[model samples]
Target: MAISYDNTGRGIKVLVNGVHMKTIPVLLLEAFKNHHGKIAFDKKRRITPEERKLLHSYLVYLKWIRKLRKTEKHLYQLIKDTYPVATRKVITLDSERFELVLDNNLKIKCPEKIYLLFTEKPVIIHSNY
Candidate 1:
């Protein structure tokens, strides 16, 4: 994995590794998706020519934004208050596809580039209220 950061660049790192396109592991993908942020891809993975091009496009996009995880305080309330009315837990939506698991489902859809924007952050979350 290679991380590139310049003296004047924002406090972000870009990791470039081979791309591998496969169905993300369910549990890990679930937890990763739960966040309101973007992650970047930096590890080596075997991928087809088409997938490699797409993945490369996503990586280039990452160098421009300050991607952050979704803050529950910022997005959850909106989901809770607006969801039951518009969409429900059964609804699964991705930027490219929408799977309605229930009525009035209108879940937010984000692109995969978000995941590739952050590949080094810890996968665990700690909370206290």
Candidate 2:
């Protein structure tokens, strides 16, 4: 499966065998599944030290934002300004969710359509240039 984020940041374009499959919302999603499955993504690109440092900082920033939302309203406002987060996007699967390999040694839960597209055959995931 090839996943590409829309250039306008509207949604995620999912492709199967070079054909359009579905477009999902742009979300920070986490996938959970109990069943073992095949993964086609490359796992050889280890995160560099600098990238690890940046990732750590990003996690800390998210933690701070969560804390600020509860404890410091003014500070949160100053931080987020007018950028209100959109409503959460949820995916419900009848069977166990599938494991989706992502960059930076990450894995996410995706619906069956997306999962089958990726696991049924090898695919080259592309980025929007």
Candidate 3:
């Protein structure tokens, strides 16, 4: 998957497997809240470090999903319904770790090791094992 800025430089174009997907705004400020837990854009609409990290993680996850959709059809079908809901929920990636805060107030921790496998290196298992 590849992400590029739109010609206007105000939105992002997400491409999967060389196919163009929909373009969304570069910054989804409404999907996030401020440090004080406020969801208003009173201050400047700047992308914080936490937001940047969360966005990067989301992109990596999307790429992984695209790969899984092709190689693991069953698994992809099982989780497809949850993907949209999960993406719409609030996410926070701070010094401690990555966390997904759901609408029902349920908190889920994102595994860094799994993300590393998709973004950095793949884990290889020998047939002998």
Candidate 4:
């Protein structure tokens, strides 16, 4: 399924046995079903100011997370190629989170999107390759 956010044919594109049958995200269906077993979108010519604000906030958050994940995956892949291997885990505290991939001689810590606000610290280690 192709999940394209903010597109007309957006949501999870589903294929049944390798044939495109539905073009909606399956997870979206699950979300709607979980909330009330139905899809609830505020449909109106002009949304209320507050509603628009909330919608904007959600979309912005999604974009921020998507970009952050891309950055993280790229970095992780790079490190994985150079390093022997690592046990990966996520640590979340309050509004912040980080990924820790531990090898016998090293611990790789990658911060989340919110980590940019603080003073980031860099730790160097010697690796015998």
On TM-score, the leading prediction is 3
**Model 3 regions more than 4 Å off:** 1-7, 10-42, 83-129
Using lDDT as the measure, name the better of candidate 1 and candidate 2.
2
Worst 10 residues of 2 by lDDT: 28-37
Model 4, global lDDT: 0.38
TM-scores for all predictions: 0.19, 0.31, 0.39, 0.26
Prediction RMSDs, each to the true structure? 15.3, 19.1, 14.0, 13.3
* Evaluation by TM-score, superior candidate among 2 and 3: 3
- Which parts of model 2 are misplaced by more than 4 Å? 1-44, 81-129
* lDDT scores of the candidates, listed in order: 0.32, 0.39, 0.43, 0.38
Candidate 2 — number of clashing residue pairs? 1
Best by lDDT: 3
- Give the higher-lDDT candidate: 2 or 3: 3
Tens-place lDDT per residue, model 2, 2-61, is: 343333376444444565544433432111011001212233233334433333433444
Error of 3 at 68 (Å): 0.4
What are the per-residue Cα lDDT tens digits for candidate 1 across 34-83? 32133434352333344444444434433322232243344444334221
Sort by TM-score, best first: what order? 3, 2, 4, 1
The parts of candidate 1 lying over 4 Å away from their true place are: 1-45, 67-129
- Please give the distance, in angstroms, between residue 46's alpha carbon in candidate 1 and its true position after superposition: 3.0
On residues 70-129, what C-alpha lDDT tens digit does candidate 3 reach at each position? 988976675543422231122234334433333455434445643342233232322321
